[model samples]
Target: MSEPVKKKAVQHLLVWMPNWLGDVVFALPTLQALRKQYPEARLTVVARPPVSEILPCHPDIDCVIPIPTEIGKRALAQMRFAFSLRKYHFDLAVILPNSLRSAWLTLLSGAPRRIGYETDGRNFLLTDPLPVVKESRSIHGSDYFAGIVKPLGIETVDKTYPQLLTPDAIGKQRELLKRMGADPSRNLVIAVAPGASKPEKRWQTERFGILCQKLVKDKDAKILLFGSGGERELLDEVRRFCPGKSAFLLAGLNLQVVAGLLGNCRLLVANDSGLMNFAAMIDTPVVGIFGPGHPKTTDPPIAPERKELVTLNFECSPCRHRFFKECEPSPNKKPFCLEDITVTQVARAVDALLDRLA
Candidate 1:
């Protein structure tokens, strides 16, 4: 049996946020529910520089302490960071990541009550360890994360995604679009994120280009291609297919700027990735092209109607995230599931979503 907790009694709550941007988004509802349950408690989140930099300004979060992102010295940095958390005297700590290091950090923080899912051989470190799904992504990631706080009495997580965009963010993105020669205020703006963490997860670049070209010609839309600095080559490749068109390469911008720009867009078309999740969270309709991995794992509660997923659901469909690493490509050297998804399929999805919004 779990220990009883007075909902409003918890103070100085510490949350160890997940590393992945998508994971951070999925984990937010749990925190949101906690805020309602413990309104008087001061909530603080610990995240890396990337995740910390992009988190929206939320009333629930009183403070955000960024730990170091130096990969070379990660263990040592976390150990030091954990030691530093002792002074805050957090009344309770919620560990979001399933990694052992996350659990170890909570243990070292000396937080009297620590709660997290039991996995990665770190169960012994938590004061309350919850049962983990056999495969973390076997179900919705948000559900898995929301369940982590059950021990603390946050039982029912609402079927809603957090509102991630602020007025300032939306304004900044609009301004950026203007400077980039994009008339966002007057024209249809569609965001295209062509890069995924795994190459296996991405749809064909040529197909993305075709979709961009179609959207630009049919809807008279401005295309903003979003990606990190490293993905410049990928976006560049996507542009080659949309030559002499409205598609503008927006590679290398920070997540905040990207989110801001995305908010100005009428819709986003992308493969299954954090950016797709980000766009959906911000209330921008998305047409997600997925294969190899199932959307069931990370789909938000109320996002099904707002976003459309294009998957062939092949016989060998949903090899899941694990299969991304060991993917066996077709003779064309593309994932069979994704390669079969035509430009028309994705475009229709985009049109259906946009039409509904219209």
Candidate 2:
């Protein structure tokens, strides 16, 4: 009788990364775990354009395939991406994001072993489908992603926060600061990210302006306001309230540059957004303002002592609803859950962080 042939080990692994910036940060631990399990394998990451930009410098990833951002052409984009991925001949495809679209792409890639959570009705597509537990949804985002890899013999240990930076990026940060009239040598630099993807997740910009003024006056800190170009108008509104040389708007900068700038800061005060997670990843002290989102599910995996989460515990506070249309409007037309959190409360939290560092 002829001897049976042995199965070959996984040599090329393809990872379908999460879509949102914060979600992408949360998946870093899983990416690290995958790298540990298959150290010899060529790891490729498939991500959206914004998420792809932040991941190209990641140590574990060999390459990043960025999908086009145009919503109207995403179907064609995915087809093109799948065709490109087929050339790599991936042995295993890990779908980190629980979406039907992700599963379809994995299926289309013709990977031999497809592993992912059995949510979104895509279980039939996966060779190894891990059952989704309702309780798991409430866990921290980093932990949530890490759990998906446990069935593949990769142990999920304490969350690993990935650091992304280069010497060139750091140098650019210093130049950017100087151009913005910020003297890092003269004063402590504090970064403030007042924008959140969701309007309800954002604390009132007026409150942020007040907090900036207070930080400038009391903490003797230079405010480095960070946000996307889309948020330039919102940052301008905050600038209107905070009129001084102390606050410098650093909008529209490269994401890596932003990460490097945040790394240089003494502290980062941000709404529950991607920048907040980025600060934590870079080991910068963070003061996160929470409102509609619960810190339990999305909190950065930083030491509690180093991070201060300021939030109100309203019954409907952590609705986790993505849009205003999904929620019932408050009487004042503003999210009361966020409106209830006072500037004094957030300032006090900021003071606590500063005092701890001091």
Candidate 3:
């Protein structure tokens, strides 16, 4: 009789999560699968600062270690973080982000098995480099992450929407809404996220303001402006265009608080941003405005009946370029792909979604 094959023991696992909020939301399915695969193993997540804010307290993850966003400026901190990880002696490492830095960190921690996609020229650093499929290149973000982890003996079926807030979090958010003068009982609450990490991805603030005004006038919807501290000016611009009683600006709030507040919203209107994905995760209906970002690859993974994407399909619609310098500007010096998406189009989409809800 042939000898029984020995299963390798894996006691500790480390996952280097994606830096962006949307990407992290997309990767939650894989994280959950990893937990189910190794229920007894200690799983640790190394992530960027914003990740801590978005991820709910879950038993799947044993602990979370946060790192600075600017890795280039914090070489000492990176080294210290890597050294600290070495103490855990993780048996396996999963690199979710395609950046070379993420792969380097996994190598630094000395994990025996490093699994990741063979992208960003970091194949040499990965022990099990998965090939990028053409089909996955244009699919939802959650599907892309699921494909990478399929080789780990985990079934990738059932790509359900990820949840970010617990019951307590929802209650806290209701209290926050009361404090902010938003009466969910009286009017339908609509959350608006006007800022994105890249300028190319953001729709005009003026258009957002116009949309809010129309919603307030026609639908009697209460607008909640959500963004970071840096986006305060953009939020202010929208506020300037809106009636004071119709809109409330909630900038610079922590991620958990924002998620809680978003949970109470009936709808979310946002650019192709992290908060856009957050809304989808929490089961809120979303109307996403796409510019340079490709909807196929990054659209919120929500049910079709509950979400809508507004975009102008020009030849150069999804340039995918990070900066304006790399893009070919229109006569008005703005990317027509987004600039051409008129206020009327967005308002119509929002109206359609609200109609469905009603």
TM-score of 1: 0.91
Query: What lDDT score goes with residue 284 in model 1?
Result: 82
lDDT tens digits, residue span 257-354, model 1: 78788889888888888888878887888888888767777663335678888888776556655553666776656788888889989988998998
Backbone clashes, each candidate? 0, 0, 0
Evaluate model 2: give its TM-score: 0.91
* lDDT tens digits by residue: candidate 3, 1-358: 0121112567888889998888888888888888878788888999887777655475578888777566655768777678778989998888999888889888989897888888889989988888866666457788888877777866564666445577898888888777777877767899999999877677877788888888888877889999988989999899877776778889988888887888889889999898898788878899999888778778787889999899876665456564567766665455778878889999998889988988
lDDT of all predictions: 0.81, 0.81, 0.81
> TM-score of the candidate numbered 3?
0.91
Q: Kindly list the per-residue Cα lDDT of model 2 for residues 157-270, writing each as its tens digit.
A: 556655577667777787778777776666789989999988877888888998888887876778888998899988877766554688888788777778788877888999
Q: List the residue pairs that clash in candidate 3.
A: none
